[model samples]
Target: MNVLVTGATGTVGAHVVDGLRYAPDAAVTAASRDPVTARERLDCATVGFDFTDPTTYRDAFAEIDALLLVRPPALSRVRRDIIPALSAAVGAGVEFVVFLSVIGADRNPLVPHARIESWIADSGLETTFLRASFFMQNLSTTHREEIRDGRLAVPAGDGKTSFVDARDVADVAVRALREGITGAYDLTGPDALSYAEVCAVLSATLEREVEYTDPSLPRFLVSRYRLEGDLAKAGVMAAIYTTARLGLAARVTDDVRSLLGRPPTDFRAFVRDNRTVWT
Candidate 1:
């Protein structure tokens, strides 16, 4: 059962290494600080882990039994040194970890996602916390230049968001790393719209006219782009329009159809299945 999928070519760690590629006896291992862009987007066998080199995580934790941990959205290079290189890979034996937390992670402390969910709930290994949401592939990776300039612009006014499906949060983080489950799963989306109903379902799945512009959370964090640095970005534009002005990420949850049996894909089927990455 050797997992190890930390941001291995991201967007839910490339669908948790393509849903653990049918796990014949599970052995995935695609950690990455670019083993040539995780071996050109991960077929597998790509290493070089780099949480700013905690001596490259003992050759990416060698026989790494379980890990799927992806908390690297930069936040000043993981608030200065990747949570002690993920608590020194649970003191070098890295048993089970799965964390990809978000969605008001235990009430966002200026969003380092509640300091990486309190360092994976005080890391003593065996954790789960997937908690994902707000990622309908950020309309083709980080709001693709405001959906290629048609403007689904910022400061999220109506704020509601249940948009989940990054390969259904990588098939529920590869089914909590092949069934070692544990806790915290808020992985949303079966519908909870309102970024003006997700720009009226991306203007009817890219028929055009995609405009949801609400400008002032520090002027949409100075015109957002990878939410520009210096760590506050107006406290992530006042916690994403105060989670859509206190609708609190709307609601809608069957916990991804009770953990991926089905039914989590809407955002108008993720804009008619990625509408050519927003026209």
Candidate 2:
């Protein structure tokens, strides 16, 4: 299998690239804007790919059998940026596509992932959609500084979220790429946890008191904007947390265990494994 992984250097995508290395039958290529850096970091075959640049598409998709398609967070205009690239992939004879999508994207047409999923399905190409839940890495990466400072603040209210590990999501994605699995799978962890419960786990792992400041929507928007210095990005994040606040992100599923043949990693296990980030 000749697999090309887009967003190959990102959170889940990086792990996907790493997992594909051990798949004997798969020839993995990490697609990046900078092929040189990607080659050095991932130590794999790479092709320079920019979604906005049509010229880069030909070589990126050339002779590729399967594509691990991941939408870069910065690119929200799917029709303008993603659809063209996917069209190019089809033209280049790419047979299978494993799209990394978000949970509830199928029902929510407002999100860009839904549009991409629709386009891929309409393209008549064999595809698998891995609709993953909230990533546990968010705490370690996006909210690391806050957690390290002993406070975790978001507008998630008392609603619980089923956070899945990026490593597990990557494993399932690799399996889909290699085996050509068809159908949508909702990948989530074993339990749904509220922010307070999540903080408790963090406290246990780091041996320090971790607090969850359940800020109001307006307060969250202001704080996030102040932290990120981008109101647009902050607004997007607020919307995501709003969904969590509404209890829309708490669904747990057996797809992870069914796909990986093992139980999904729990929040406590994830925090324990990555405790150094908080420390």
Candidate 3:
């Protein structure tokens, strides 16, 4: 089966590539905006693809059978980018889609994942929604600087989130693509923990004290904007944290075990395995 994996450079997508490496059925194509650089980095067949650009879809989806769609967090305009890409995929005769959506995306309209998930369902193509929880890799990427400084800043209020590892998400994606499973699967870690609890785990795992900074939205937005120089993106990010702060993203699910036939990786195990990144 020909599979096009979007966001090829990302944590989840990279692992998807790794999982499919041994899958005899999947001829995986890693799709990124810069196919030349992607080829060098991913060491796989690469194609130039962008959700925002309709023209890139034609060649990228050429003879493609299934899609592993990962919306880069920067792209927020679902109506403009996502729907058009799905339309293009349909036109390209792409039959199956395994979309990586966020946990509670169906109910939470604050983010673009919900809208994108809706569009995939309404597209009449066979679809499988991988409703993933907060990624455990956030410690190494988004919150790395904060974690390095001994504090993880966010506006999670009193909420708890099940932080699933990207590897598990990718493994599930590989299976769903190969088996062509339809409907939705909520991928989450075994335990649901608040930010404070997460920090405790980090402290224990890293053997150093880590604190949780529950900053206000405005402060987070301004700080992130100053750091990233993108107000719109920062605001969108703030809204995502705000939604989690409202206790909307705290649910834990057994879909990972059900999909993989084994228990998903837990927080302490993730931190222990990735300890070098923090140090």
Question: Candidate 2 — which residues are off by over 4 angstroms?
Answer: none
The runs of at least 3 residues in candidate 1 whose Cα sits more than 4 Å from the true structure, single-residue gaps closed, are 3-50, 75-132, 135-154, 158-160, 163-171, 174-176, 179-187, 195-214, 222-255, 258-279
Question: What are the lDDT scores of the predictions, listed in order?
Answer: 0.75, 0.90, 0.87
Query: Candidate 3, residue 173: CA error in Å?
Result: 0.2
lDDT of 3 by residue, 1-279 (tens): 999999988999988887786689899999999999988887889999988888898999999999999998778887876788889889999999999988888888887888888788888989999998889997788888879889988888878888899899998999999998888988999988899999998899888999998988889988998888987688777776776788877888889998899999989888888888888
Per-model TM-score on C-alpha atoms: 0.32, 0.95, 0.96
Q: Who wins the lDDT comparison?
A: 2
- Estimate the TM-score for candidate 2: 0.95
* Cα lDDT tens digits for candidate 2, 129-210: 9998889998899999999999999999998999999899999998888888999999999999999999998998789999
In model 3, state the lDDT of residue 83: 82
The best candidate by TM-score is 3
* lDDT ranking, high to low: 2, 3, 1
RMSD of 1: 16.0
The stretch of ten residues in a row with the least summed lDDT in candidate 3 is 235-244
